[model samples]
Target: MFNLSYKAQRYLILFGFLTIPVVLSLMFSYYPAFSLLYYSFTDWTGLGWEMHWVGFANYKEVFTRPEIFSVFEHNAYYFVGGLIQTAVALFFAVILTGKLKGRNVFRAMLFLPYVLHSVAIVIMFKNVYHSEYGSLNLFLQSIGLGSWQQEWLGNPHLVNVSLAFISVWKFFGLSMVIFIGALQSIPADLYEAAKIDGASGWQAFRFITVPSIRSVIEMMMILTLTGALEAFDIPYIMMLGANGTDTFVSKTVDMAFKFQQAGLASAMAVVLLLIVMFFIFIQRKLLFRGGE
Candidate 1:
């Protein structure tokens, strides 16, 4: 038997534990990513192995196609809704952090939607947004506010907004939980000290609470941006990307599967990836500009 030092044995064990995950990551994540990048420059129909290098033709088409690029406008509604959701979540998190009764129950109820199946949630909302027989419209009529009812998923002016609201309602609870965790991690003494220095409630929150949870807020902002850019399920499920509710992701999926334009789809994916990365970089720079 060969003898080895304790340090060498530990190193070997560590490497053994990491080997499978590293290999799997390279195989699944990196390899597919690189392959996608390569295919973006080629004309592959995604049906067979046949592919031809087409340079930036796919990229050019993506840029030149007005209808293809215009789907990004739909993402803006979700992005704005995500911002509103974050703000609402932060507000509730702050409130729940206080000595409120039934706060735990409230938190659980708030988080319930996130744990539910995504497909079920979408289907439920589809029924809720039905033009003729939706519960929303019925409730409005019952309340003598029937005039407020409109075609939620049908009207071009309101379809995106309707879908965006669903995203906010479904995901805001998760953001609230995260914000609550961040808020709880903040030391109570900081607020006490601020109060001792005669800081007002708004001043305390603005200065101490905001700065303490700055990193979490930044994370939530990044999530909001990415989620908006990746909005697909609700719009796709409810309206099938009709009535101007199509998002960038749904368009990409259509290009890839429905149209069999694999190369063009890959290019669109790369474009979305670049756009997400650019926004994330800009977000990081702006959020951490004070070196926090």
Candidate 2:
């Protein structure tokens, strides 16, 4: 060690610290990922080693079927729902950051659900959406809006929207928190300067608030896009992916576990991964490249 240069000593220590994580990552992450890719080309029931190569058959099935493609459409509903959630969150964040009474309490109340378990939330909403005795139907009856109430979960047409609402309720708080942080990072003097220039509230918000937080909004869009595409849990738990509520990830799980078709599930997974990666690439090029 005494004979080694100072830079060499630092490099050696850094290599020692990275060794465990690098080895673990290769064993756990990379190994399973490559295995999934390989499994996509084979006929495996996920229960045995005796499997035969069946290249592209599963991929062909995934791309050809309308029922499977409907899951992709459901994913788009989730994405649109997230955009609505983002807009609502942004509105709340903007108001909360302004000089208003009890804003902290309001923020805390709004953010409460973001910290709750998603499964628990899903279970709770499952009951809330019940057609017969659910709170939603009961409330509508109380308000003389009984005609407006329909089967929130039972019907195929309303199931996706109902589930999407649940997702928005769960996630908007998180979006609000992210927007709050982004709003705080914006310079107060900009608003002050705008006000001095006789800017209206709407004008300041449109020009200053929106433009300044462009990057954060772009980040949220990417996140929501990916999250919506990969949505599984709430729909799975609430509807078991039934009645137009099935999404890409939920369908993948059903295929792999319920039907014991690991090869087809792997193909679905690979296709979904490619779609997500392609969107990420587009967002990176347009929104994130060469800048913070």
Candidate 3:
């Protein structure tokens, strides 16, 4: 009877401990998310006490609209561009982890951009990339590459690329830090063994460093992909005053606030959610399998 009382008391204590967070999460997070999912299928204008059932109409509109599709394409550009940045960060991480001079100072310098306010960073880049009276153009003209200077953000063909370059600059520091941690966690004896086996540095990296950091790389890839998909702040701030650039790349904020098309904006949000889920599914299959 005493043992049973003790067991029951222990179970009660554990349940008492978890019940608060569980209730709070259900009330705050889970319920709101579920409400959003339900609202996505309805024509809820985000105001008013009434909603209309619309089935898949919102999704259909999202797919049939070229502007919306362009948003997806721009998001894809971000994904690919972030991956390139992550790769470059990993390279730098490897070098910094090696016997390099003033490595800590270099790492701190590289990471400084990430700590700055994103709006400030974008504004700084805006000045740098200005078509007239800009430093970039001035330097280009000085070097006889005058023809190479162009309105970077104004050109439709280059706007997304410009945003991507800024994103890479702001985010590469995070990837570098992650990669450095992963590199440090690797056992040095493995590298020494490969060296004793006459493996070149590249060969050692391929077989030792790459495989050892595979899990960390996968985690960073997932984070980068999600961050890119939901990118809003930098592009929003940069393209605020522009006109006729209302492609998917620039209309997200306007669709939500300026136009007050809450249902449509909710639909866009849902599409973004599905994209993240798809990537997560793919990551689970390709990267998280076999307990790695």
Candidate 4:
């Protein structure tokens, strides 16, 4: 028998305990994803014991089909909407982190949305966007902007945009909180030093604040991209059972459960996963390459 040092034996025991949960978690979490990837190349309907391997048929179909293309386009729209919302959150975060009154109150209010259940929020917004008796249309009419009132989530043309608005409202609070935390972590001494060196407010922000919070900004960007790519709940709940508006952005769950096209849905899921991984890789390369 081989004898190990006391430190080495302790390390082995610690590693065993720590690695057990990690191994179990990976099995449960990643096994489904791997199964999805495998099923994407098959003709499985997510039922029965029989499944035929179809190779790249799913991928070929997704690319050649107009509906799939439309879904991808709507996904792009979702990503853009998320980006705009993140920008708005960053703006508000900067203001709240600066010398301002009632900053804590504002932060709490902004963070309130993030703590609510997403389904509840979506249901609430659905009523709010109703065409006739909705608060939004009523407010528009009261403000003499009745011409702007239209079927928000019902109109095919405006459905995506309307969903985007709700997505922003629900998610911007999280980005704002993240940005606020990042901004606060930045030292005030840096700003003071810049001031003493005759730097303007804008210059200080550009050089000191932005640079100091680069890592957090990068992390948030990755998170926003992933969230946008996987966005399903709001769009699905908003446009449930609606025709014409059942494009790619709102068809993922329906494709799997309603149509029983599990293979195709899994293919689309794989594509979305690839997109998220690509963005994460690009962000890592660009933002986290050096120890700056």
Candidate 5:
């Protein structure tokens, strides 16, 4: 038997620790991703091994079809909701970071929804959005505002908005928590210095607070954008993508599972991945360029 040096033994131990994770990643993540890319160019029905090469046909269908591309319009609602959610989260984060009475309780209340089961949340909202028996409509009626009641998940015009609101409500607290952490890290002396320099509240927040938490804000924005683009849970669980509430991910799922068009679904998945990557790239560029 040969004796090993300390550095070599350390390297061997590190390699052993990494081996399982690296192999698992390759098998589960990379392999499926590459297989999806390959199947995008084939006529695979996602069953058995009977697939034929049909290059670009799936991609062509994805791009040329009006109904297919139109689902992105639904995604826009979630994007808008995400923007609203980010703003609200930032506002609450700033407020809670201050010397407010019982701010911890408020923070816990806000964050409770995020920790709940997603299915339970959807089911809870389903009852809340029911036209006749919903809590929202009932409250409106109790407040003598019965005229404001409408089909939240039934009307095509308002369905996406309702679903988007659910997403915002579920996720905003997480964003608020992240923002709070970032805000808390900013030095207290900076605010004092700004006060000493006769900086008004708005002026200090604009110049000092914004710049200080810019990176956290940017990260939250990216998360919001991606979450909006990949929105599937709220809409799918609530209405199964009915009444014009279908997002890009839901549509892709329908193509693959419901329609048995795995190839087209793969194409759509690839397109979604590319779109997400493109936006992330643009975000990084803007961040590094400092809005230039």
Candidate 6:
């Protein structure tokens, strides 16, 4: 019998533990992915078995199409909204991580929204944003600022923004939680050292806090961008992709189920994946790994 090398034997043992999960993932994730990729090149209307190979036609139509382009525009609204959410969350995190009364309570309150169901949030906010007798309008009227009241979910111009706001309110807590973890992990010695050198509050924050938490900030930025790009639930539940609040994922789902254009939708999905991958590549190269 032949004896395997020590490294080869170790690798065999490692593969024994990893094999099942790796196989399962390949079967479920990668298999579906490759199938979707192949189907994107075909005219496979989800209902039928007559999948005609149409080579790049689906891809061409996806870009050359304008309705889908409008969908992409909607995604931009969510992306900007997510960035705003991240900024707000970061501010809250910075405050909460510092010396303050009831920091734990405040953290729990901020993080509460993230754990709530999207359906519940959508239903609750739907009333909150109602144009006529909604809580928002009522408050504005009572506060002597009625002119600021506008149709939050009705007006097409504001619908996306309104939806974006709800999305931000619901998920900003996640970013806050991440920021808190990163901030707390930072060494206290650095701040003390800076203070001993007569560093001002702004200087300590700028030089020490910012530099220490920079990686976390970068990670959050990527997460926020990706989350915004793929935004769906709040917009979908509230607007159903109507009034120009359709995101790419929502639109793709609509195509597959509502329009039954599975092939085209698959093609759209592939394009979106490519776009997301492109952004990730750019960020990894330009932002994260720029120093190396």
User: What lDDT does candidate 5 reach at residue 259?
Assistant: 91
Query: Per-prediction TM-score, please?
Result: 0.96, 0.93, 0.87, 0.89, 0.96, 0.93
- lDDT digits (tens) for residues 30-128 of candidate 4: 888788899999988877857899999988887787876566556665678888988889899999998899999999898888788878988898788
131 Cα displacement, candidate 5 (Å): 1.1
What digit string (tens of lDDT, one per residue) describes model 1 on residues 196-291?
999998999999999888888888999999999999988898778888888999998988899899999999999999999999999888767785
Off by over 4 Å in 6: 1-13
lDDT of each: 0.92, 0.90, 0.82, 0.81, 0.92, 0.88
Counted clashes in each candidate structure: 0, 0, 0, 0, 0, 0
lDDT at 274, model 2? 95
Residue 34 lDDT in model 2? 98
Off by over 4 Å in 1: 1-3
Report the error of model 1 at residue 84, Å: 0.2
Q: Can you write out model 6's per-residue Cα lDDT over 84-113, one digit (the tens) per residue?
A: 888788789889989999999999998999
Model 3 agreement with the true structure over 186-272: per-residue lDDT tens digits: 999999999999999999999899889888888888888788777777877888625333335356557767776666767777777
Model with the higher lDDT, candidate 2 or 3: 2
Ranking by lDDT: 1, 5, 2, 6, 3, 4
Model 1 weakest lDDT span, ten residues long: 283-292
Angstrom error of the Cα, residue 176, model 3: value is 0.3
- Residues 1-292, candidate 5: write the lDDT tens digits: 1398888898888999999999999999999999999999998998887999999999999999999889999999989999999999999999999999999999999999899888999999989999999999999999999999999988898988888898999998899999999999999999999999999989988999999988888888899889989999878988898788888999999999999999999999999999999998988897646834
- Sliding window of 10 residues with minimal summed lDDT for model 2: 283-292
Q: Which 10 consecutive positions of candidate 3 have the poorest summed lDDT? A: 241-250
Question: What's model 5's lDDT at 149?
Answer: 99
Which TM-score value belongs to model 3?
0.87
